[model samples]
Target: MINNSSHVNWRPTADIQSLRQRAVIIANIRQFFALRNVLEVETPCLSNATVSDLHMRAFCTQFNDPMSPQQKTLYLQTSPEYAMKRLLCAGSGAIYQIAKAFRNEEAGKYHNPEFTMLEWYRPDFDHVQLMNELDELVQQIVGCEPSNRMTYQQSFKEHLSLDPLSASLEELQKRGCALGYEHICRDEQDKDTILQLLFSHEIEPNIAKQRPCFIYDFPASQAALARINLQDQRVAERFELYYKGIELANGFHELANVSEQRQRFDADNAQRRAFDLPPVVTDEFFLAALESGLPNCAGVAVGIDRLIMLALNKTKIAQVIAFNYQNA
Candidate 1:
């Protein structure tokens, strides 16, 4: 015999009032983009490839076919970027997508495994133009002007008194220890970890308290796929928008070099190997498209659920999601 008297904690769903507000904001956003002639699109959630970024983890699935002794692998896309860029290469005009993206390791007050993302690309536009448009889009959605803009170098110098473009690994480690970092890496380090630590601790909390802020001109090593600014050879033309100290979006001046991109992808896989993680096969289709020709463009992605939560002053991401991970 089993005991049958267990009580279940039945938490309610997202607040209806907040949901309505989110709906309104989304509607307005659609109107803004539609008026600007941006074509809305949808891409598959599952794919054979995933982002090459070392930090982002993708969820994988396996399929077995009975007709033949064959197995297939699929990944829940971390971002819709690859597919959207393929469309760009195929001459799709200015396009945007409201997509549900997945990540495996992210779960916290401000993060969930699954969340909504608003991604867009503008052909023939540089990162500067996209930055301005980011400001306009946020203001139009929130009905308020954002704060101001600052470069990555300026931000680091102002907050940590460290030059991110030239700071040594030892200096970064020292700063991290001084700031109460318990898990500092002793091995040879790169700029990414140092920048992430500083951004999360010193700079992020102090940004956009009054309004939104755009932190642009990232170090060249952190460019990912963004193009380096010709005037500033040490920095890439990329920007991240922050609102109330929460990161809302990231944009890039697309790098259209196929060979360079392939090399970066290989490097990422090599890093994965060093970390004892399995390397994903490269997306040959996307690479072939790049080889053929991708339009000169700028692209960006905004966290929609975060935006909704911000609009309602909700602190926990679970409050906005229909079913939190534990519940799911």
Candidate 2:
């Protein structure tokens, strides 16, 4: 005897209207890219490796093979970045993908274990150019006002009155403490980590409230897959778009040097060790693609659900998606 009544609350989180609006927006996005000749593409949802970023967690599952006497663990891709870049190395011209990505993270109004991502790459385009195109796309879909561009240094200076580029570790920590964050964890006291904490807590809420904006040229330490600026080695050619102080996208001038990428991956593993987190293995296939000459390109990943949320004036991501994590 089992009970299967109304206790489950089995219904979609989003309404029918939202689903229709989402479809229209997605169609518009495809048309926007199609006009620019950017081909839509797809990649595997599972991967042999995972993100090395110290802040993110990846979900994993075991795969057993009948033809072989071994079981291999597969990670749900946190982003389709590495695989997409492999396609770029294979000379798949300008490409875009609306993908489902996964990350084991704290559930919140803005976060889910599984979410939709709109990612793309453009050859011969720098981060600046990508920002321009992204701004156009956002305006086209969400009808936001034209976005403005600001450098990361300018943002920190305007908001905190501190120079993030040359700020010492002690200075950053001191600022964090002054901002009432005295009990931060020991493992998270690194320069970039502290900077991110300050940015998210103090700065993000105040940026681009009236219109969208792009903040570019991030600290070299926080580059991730972005290439470092040649003229100013202290910063990397990375940018993020924000609307009403909410982050909408992140872009980077793709790092093409194999040796430098390997070094960055090792550095990430070292940081993971410092934080007592399991070190993630580097994706050799991605590195091999880089070695075989990835074309010079700029790339970005956007949150489609978030975009839908903004478009519908919905506060929670669940209001824009068919099923949220809990409901699903």
Candidate 3:
């Protein structure tokens, strides 16, 4: 981390020209949405409740009441998902937002504690239609062609000669060990985690290197907010976009079943307890909105900084952001 007193660290990581380019990109994004008649909206950055995803840790602060004696803890939103879904439930059709998001336990070449997120929702769109729209938006921003699409099973089969969906835990462990991950005790790890490890370390690097690629239909165990496929009950209607092995976006065909959504939230909290992490309070309001009937929709959150990094051919995420966590 750079010392706070350092003069050079006070300057923006990105050059002035790059900042200007970023502005142009943001303008283009607004234009793209405006042409499609998608209303741009804003939501709260801090909330009384936050995501219960086991993989994400939210930054929190105590909100001391000046007029009252009560103090409440508020969490910085990891994504604008829940609030946007609430809007969708209120009959806001096809909305988008560019907002600041925060996550704890993240800081590296490709990650920062705080970053910009471009999130949007389409009320009647399915995951495939959303994927096509995402492809168009990305291509417009980066001047790249439409991304190649593949299923998660196909990616694993083509890259590692393994079927991720059908592979047993023992098979996954054996393959992981053979691939130089002997340090991990396969027997103690879950199948989904093992699949993630292999996909990140081996298969991902071989995905479309010159253009973007969309990997869809993930295992049911890996689904966060995505609905499960009816034809194939073992997979979820989830997809992630990657460019040169770097994940840029994650989208889901929104799960509207209240009972299932609550169960997922409970499971996430249970996993958090197992991991020795503090359990986050479930967003009751968001669940209430879900109960009120959120329209069938698809939503996606894209890392704007990472997109800029790729567009400018920059190696580090800090090169695109005005100020990184260390300096901020």
Candidate 4:
């Protein structure tokens, strides 16, 4: 019932040749996992609970329970993380999943509301060991060399001549102002927010310009699900991979303490409430699994579309995605 003119824009964003190349890359990913004995996993795309991260928003829907004749709200999963961790707790060992994840209010040259995520968990591996494996995977996928690893503080010091951890709020604000983010209200922002603004505006653009790089040991306040470093309580054992100034992956030494996890979730919800955003319900099942005991593991989530973009030398994420959100 639609006109041909209107249908003209319905074509896929990626050409057939590009899609074929994408398929080969995906196959390579599966092969890489198979060679490492990591089990492939599949989790439900819908869940009764969603992440409490204040920065992330989940899509919601209602499920009509025929047996109870009631409607129950469900959320499209932001990632397969919660379910995958539950599996790990249930003795699935090392596992990986290439999942289609959804997030609300995300669409741009580098983002889509729906995109593929490559997530994995490795039991008995610390963040460093996981980073080694990640390096190998990236090299195999893109023929890129292994990356240099640096601490978050070191990166800031090297690039901006400021030690992020030791810098005062005023110093950070001054750095932000110097980086052309002078419009950012300094009085209302916390140290973490100011550091984030400075990093995004100044340091991040220059990182990994020559090759891929991993920045680790983030400030405790910026740790999402990472455990605090016992050696340095001020820092968390988290790392993010960047290639050509584009963020490619985020990983953490998984926080195993249930109480600490609960506190972090509560804090995130409180921040959401302060911002006048609806607070999300925390996943009780995930928490229970953690309480039962999750093994020492490190996990990482990679953006597949971005990886494809880098591999194929494409500029925009749409060049790798079959159909962007606008067309979808």
Candidate 5:
């Protein structure tokens, strides 16, 4: 951590020109939402509840009040999904937010421990329709080619000649090991995780490096908050948009069933227990909002730093942001 005692230069990671360019792109993004009449809103960045998704982790902090006897623990939100959904339940029409989000144990060329997130929810829109909107956003901002859609299963087969949906654990492991991942494969036992590893390592990098690609219909188990497809229960209505090997956005055809949502959260905790990872408390307030009935909607969270990186042709996420996590 760069603190008072640390001998580090106190300067912006991005140059003056990059900061100005970033400002312009963000201005245009706000205009894009304004033209579409999407209501811009803000939500509390710190909350009592954190995401229970198996792969997500929130930064924990303490809120100490001088008058209170206890210090309450609060979590830095990983995304604005829960709070935004509550707004939707409260009848906030189509909404959007450009906010700061934090995630633990994330820092690299493409990610930072803290980053900017542009999230939006569109009532009455399904994942497909949202993809169209997202494509327009990327094209207008980043000038990428028209996007393409490939299902989760099709992407695997097209790239590696493997069927991710039906492949058994042993089969998947064999394929992964064949791709020179035997060392990493030995420690991983989860099938969904293995598929993801293979995809990120081998498949994603080789996709259209310049154009946007949308891959949807992920395995049901991989669905964090997406609704299962009626046509094919084997997959969920989740979609991800990628450009130049970097995932730009993750969108879901929202799931509104309170009971099913609870079940999924429970399953995630159970898996955490099995993996020796600490379980997290589900957000009951969000559950109550779900019970109150969330209108049909499609929502997506976009990595604003990544989009800026693409627009400016910068290689590292640190090149576009004012301060990387290290400096912050």
Candidate 6:
């Protein structure tokens, strides 16, 4: 992790010309929202609750009072999701936030410990509408061509020739072994993990290297906070946008069912216990808002750093940032 005391010579992540070009993209994005009537909003950086996704780890900190030696637990929010949803419940119409978010132990060509996120929510819009908006926005910003939509199942079939949701553990293991995958975890791995392995190893790399692709309709177990399709209960209304093999954004058909949300949170906490990670407190305020009803909406979180990297044609995520991990 980068700190403020480093003496190493470091350079900005992107070249000045490229960075300036990306600034235009940022401006275009804001203008797109402004024209759509989506209110640009801001929320707290510190929150008492963290995301309940088992794979998402929050950075926890302690606050001590000068008068006493007691410390209070606080966490750097991974995203502005929960707070934004609460505002939606309070009748805050379509909203968007371009903010900096922090995550521990993530530093790579596509990831950073501290990075910018462009998150937005659309009230009364479902996953399909959200996908259209994403495509239009990307095209407007980068002058990229229109994007194509494919379900997760379709992507798997097109690349791996396997039906991810129906594939058995033995079948997955056989495919992995054929591909020379080591440390087979078929017995412990779920459908999502199995599909993810194949997707990363064989499928994703070959997709629209220069164009944007929208992959949607994930399996129910992998939905995270999204709602499952009532018509096809096996799949959830979730989508992820990929460009040049880099994930740019993730979106979901918002799940406002408080009971189901609670169930998912409990399951995540249980997994955290199994993994020996500290338990995260549930956000009762967010739950109250959920209970009050969240509009049938779709929301997305986009990685600003990766967007800049792609726009600048930079090879590393560190190039866009002022300081990198080794320098900081």
- The number of the candidate with the highest TM-score is 2
Compute the lDDT for candidate 3.
Answer: 0.92
The TM-scores of all predictions, comma-separated, are 0.94, 0.97, 0.96, 0.96, 0.96, 0.93
In candidate 5, which residue ranges exceed 4 Å CA deviation? Answer: 1-7, 66-68
Count of backbone clashes, every candidate in sequence: 0, 0, 0, 0, 0, 5
Clashes of 1: 0
Candidate 4, 1-328: lDDT as tens digits? 8668865677899998999999999999999999999999999999999999877889999888897778999999999999999999999999999999999975887889999999999999999999999999988887788898899999888889999889888888887877777788356367888888777777789888777999999999988999999999999999999998789999999999999999999999999999899888889999999998999999999999999999999988999888998888
Q: What is the per-residue lDDT of model 5 for residues 15-91, given as tens digits with 9 covering 90 to 100?
A: 99999999999999999999999999999999998988778778999999687899988999999999999999999
Residue 275 accuracy (lDDT) in model 5: 77
Better of 1 and 6 by lDDT: 1
Give residue 242's error in model 5 in angstroms: 0.8
lDDT of 1 by residue, 1-328 (tens): 9765466545645776777777888898899899999999999999988888888899989867576588888889888999999999999989999999999986888888988999999998999899888889887776567559999999999998999888888888778777877476344376578679778888999989888999999998888889989998999999999988789999999999999899989999999898888887899888998998999999999998888787777888777766677767
**lDDT, candidate 6, 159-195, per-residue tens:** 8899988888778887877787747544545656666
Candidate 2 lDDT over residue span 134-224, tens digit each: 9889998888899988899999999999899999888888888888887872345578878888888888999989899889999998999
User: Which is the leading candidate under lDDT?
Assistant: 5
RMSD of 5: 2.4
RMSD list, candidates in order: 2.0, 1.3, 2.4, 1.5, 2.4, 3.2
Clashes of 3: 0
Weakest lDDT window of 10 consecutive positions for candidate 6: 182-191
List the global CA lDDT of all models: 0.87, 0.92, 0.92, 0.91, 0.93, 0.85
lDDT of candidate 3 over 125-235, digit per residue (tens)? 999999999999999888887899999999999999999999888899899989888788356468888898889989788886989999999999999999999999999
Comparing 5 with 6 on lDDT, the higher-scoring candidate is 5
User: Which residue segments of model 6 deviate by more than 4 Å?
Assistant: 1-7, 65-69
Error of 2 at 248 (Å): 0.7
